[model samples]
Target: MSTVPIASSRSQWLPAYLALVVATSVATGVASWMFLPRPELGPLLLLCLMGILSFQIREPDVGLRISFSFLSIILLASAAIVGAFGAWLVGSVSMLIDRRQRRWTATMFNAAMSGFVGAAGAMVYAMLGGVEGSGTVGLSTVALARDLGWPLFAADVVACLLNAALLSGVIHFDQGIPFGVQVRRVLSGSGVAFVGYGIIGLLFVILWYPAGLGAFSALLVLAPLLAARWAFIQYGEELRSHERTIDTLVTALGTKEPAAVDRSRRAAVLAEWIAEELGLTPGQIGTVRYAATLHEIGHLGVATRLLRRSPASLSPTERRVIDGHCVVGARMIEGIDFLEDARSGIRHQHERFDGTGRPDGRAGQDIPIAARIVAVTTAIDDVIREPGAAPVVSIAEVARRLRGDPGRFDPDVVAAAVIALDKHGWPAGSPAPVAS
Candidate 1:
């Protein structure tokens, strides 16, 4: 098939995400004000939720970018906590310990130092502003526990959740997860989990509460919280698995299609096609999808001069760098567990049917099957992305290019590639496949 030129890329954003965060924060705060306490703190709760945006700050931690994601849950969950403890000060401390001090003890000492200082500061500010009542938590804090019959502890719990969200928002993190993905997975799974757990808790309340499971009623109520964590972890893994695959697909175009320059877009489309032709089971497909995207990430190490210039004009050093892309890519994904599946494929993509490939030079069946499949698709993608050169051609034509012998590709993998492209209505002619 003919290659499609890469489109001008659009910058991704978080508008919908911002709307969601604001909506949730306001909703939680409003509920707290209406049903519980602290109507004055609702607006403050909204401001604290805004802190979710802080994770986007670009900073390199060692070589890995900080994710800043796990704690977003901590923040959203903590909104009530901060609101209840509104007048209390917050703190932070970092210190180096002497030789005899245990590491954990030193860490706790620092945390305590920071926590106490922060608490003192908050109290001092409140005192200066003349917050007179010992029982009052904030300006509009509900005196419901006193005025009505609600337990103070329950009111404090709601306040604690709010406080956690606010503090989580403000606390700067060096690294974590993408807030968007985190939100998606958290929302997707937690929505389902909350409902499920709610039903279970309802049954427990209906059946057990009357039967005097009173000693454990509070513990039974904690089910939904536990469900939230379980749901988050499970769904987060699913989200991350796909994320790794998309990264893999991008890696492929970046490396093998270096000369084509339209690689990112082209490889993405081909990856979609290959995913179908390979007849991957849904779970396996997810892994394959991510692996294909990152199959050429090592190519990033190749010098721009060498990538663009004629091979004849390349210097020895540049050639070495160009050849070393696979190794680089493998190293890049070494830390990501789901991505480990794609590493062998990326590393071996350049390997030939005969054993002339660089790095390890494993030949034929010795090479991982995934690597072979990636190699064939990569070749086809490059041809399609070729600028001004039949960028509108058909899949049959591209398949022919791939089929020509001379140790070009593993023959079975080539067949698999051709079938995949054709069945998916692939190439520059068909609608391009989308990457995550």
Candidate 2:
């Protein structure tokens, strides 16, 4: 996430924000007039086709959610019609139509954003020496390739960057995250696909004008597109399946170790709150929750009787099993791609701030932040849920116990936990200190 903080209000960002709005409006208006009156039926149909092909993909583990509409429509408009104006109308109209059911603010924002992006692309194309309305640049393969390649590519790059910048700026303002983080997240999830689609769109328009394939070529690609959509759907389904499977395993473990179950749930809740207090992004919070929920999963591999016994009463061999649960639980989910971050958190949850942890002797800030937060939250839960203990404890006592062992947990995490616990009203009592 961005290390930079957001201003308390939107007016603080107004100067540059106003510039963007004005430039976008003027550019779009000019482009629209250049394209004139309205789009032909063929282009309108293409816009609808693009919308129908759009799909939403969400990966909860990594916290990435994206709605992807193949880049074909925008790219085609940029290459074929009245330069960028064609793209603007296609994107804005399609978005307005599709999002009509959404809140007015959301629908208008989307429509305006689309128009701005399209206008930016068209302006870039014209500036790059691409003539307006010369969709068909028919020449020999080499000549046409040499002529249109650079301008088209540049236009695509400009559009991509503009889209990223505008979106990232808005997100940064809203979420108080760094622009770089938002940009990196967007690129990692969708950049490559967008670029590839742009290339295909350029090729499609080339064929439309010269080969006379026209709009019918879209029909030829329909089967392949549908097939690709099916593959994406299958991939998304498997992602959901992975999440469900992990939940089931964790629930089963809880059933076997009923005491640990409540503690785990509490740990998960506190960990998420602490993460938020520490300015972790939503994706990071999700990963922390998973790690906290399954940190004790290694206990599943140990004997049930052994788990029920107090840690101090365990034999050396039994202690080893207990110590090794982190590794065991991490191994179980290591192979799943999305849980890569969570695996590290689980493996290191037992590590001490002073190099006194198991599986590894890592120390200080070297520990994963998620793991550190989990350790503090888990400790709090353990203290409150001690057998025969009341559901309540002084928030001060909880803080003292957590801070009392600086060698065991990260101080920063402990501090965040204190604030988070107080904010969330933990220990099942008032925020004021009470006798333990």
Candidate 3:
């Protein structure tokens, strides 16, 4: 749970508006290419310019955004003569803004900031884009596009996507936990720039000066993007405001409810090794890590004492009720749009590959891939988390424990489990790593 504020630094709105400018340029470029005749290179050049601006927009605090705004105006005004230099100049301007100190993982920040400069550069490129590809408007777009090839294009697209992603990531990371943001807002807002450009190009069919119309259209897109930014801000704030309520709800469910589950610092440290052993991609690694923290969320519905009870002490009804948690947890998450992607893991995490598992009794291929991964991980975590285990146990002994009956778990899952145990120094009878 988070408590995003309603009035959090209204200044963030400035950056959001700048971001919109670049977004509109992208929207118009694509539109013009699709609807306009033969598609003169003007709008495309602007798109490229926006690409750089989108990356380079972040500058040294308050002073720079205003400064860049003016520079962008001059760059656009002088576009006919300066051409690509003007475009690159705007990108360089953003890059030049000093942030006082470099962050440990500043690469994405740098790339995204560069895009901001590119956004302004798009405006500069607007005049040149209108010069008509063959003559005065310029060949910078063609030359840059050819020179950079797919690598640059890929970078551009990634920059756009990452700019949105990184912004949300920064907010979440700074807030000190995992929480959801409205992904649709970021995507739609970023998309508007290109859309506005397209509409303007459409009007140019009868208007003649398509490039000029395209610039004005970019302004049109800016309006909506700004509103969207406000919405994003509001959404973030509302999330913050509701943090306490969500936390209380989690407490109502269980001592450590899955919905509000927070990873122990130690668990986070150990998770990295697990991720490496599994050869998980960055994205996959995040999923597994989050799954580990929320693995017990379904237990919210289970009787508290039942969780504490030994296997022998439980009544048949109590035990059955405990096993039904996966369904309960999954259903609870299904109601949330953001968590839908992880519902499969939350539900079938306790299931085995063979048809012997509880709840849905999904077998083998019927099981979701993430659920299978979680099942192995859940068992491994349990093993290490137990106290008074032997330290020098053989990997084969551990393998045998999990492999007691292949039908009880997926063969492949068991195999992966064995490797994970071995990777984490879990020799025969050794104690598993306990959650912090």
Best by lDDT: 2
Comparison by lDDT, 1 against 2, better one = 2
Q: Candidate 1 — worst ten consecutive residues by lDDT sum?
A: 1-10
Sort the candidates on lDDT, descending order: 2, 3, 1
Point out the worst 10-residue segment of candidate 3 by lDDT: 61-70
For model 1, residues 296-337, the per-residue Cα lDDT tens digits are 566666656567776668789877887788788788778877
Tell me the TM-score of each prediction against the true structure: 0.43, 0.70, 0.50
Tell me the spans in candidate 3 whose CA falls farther than 4 Å from its real position. Answer: 1-83, 95-293, 315-317, 390-405, 411-436
Candidate 3: TM-score?
A: 0.50
Which tens-of-lDDT digit does each residue in 1-436 have in candidate 2? 0011123333356346535654675567565766644446566567445643441211212224444455433444444444555666655665565522344444455555666666667666666766444445556676556455556676677666666676567655554335666776555555555555566656655655666776776676555455544544565576578678767877889888976766677677778768767767656877898888788887888788888788789889888887888899889887777688998899998899999887798899999888888788778877776666654577788898888887999988888887766655663332333553
- Candidate 2 C-alpha error for residue 356, in Å: 1.9
Backbone clash count, each prediction separately: 52, 2, 41
* Cα lDDT of model 3 by residue, 135-199, tens digit: 32223546533422222233233333544454444433332212133223333433233222322
Local error of candidate 2 at residue 346 (angstroms) = 2.1
Off by over 4 Å in 2: 1-63, 71-79, 99-102, 140-143, 165-179, 257-290, 302-324, 331-344, 365-370, 376-404, 410-436
Query: Candidate 1 at residue 209, lDDT?
Result: 24
Model 3 lDDT at residue 256: 44
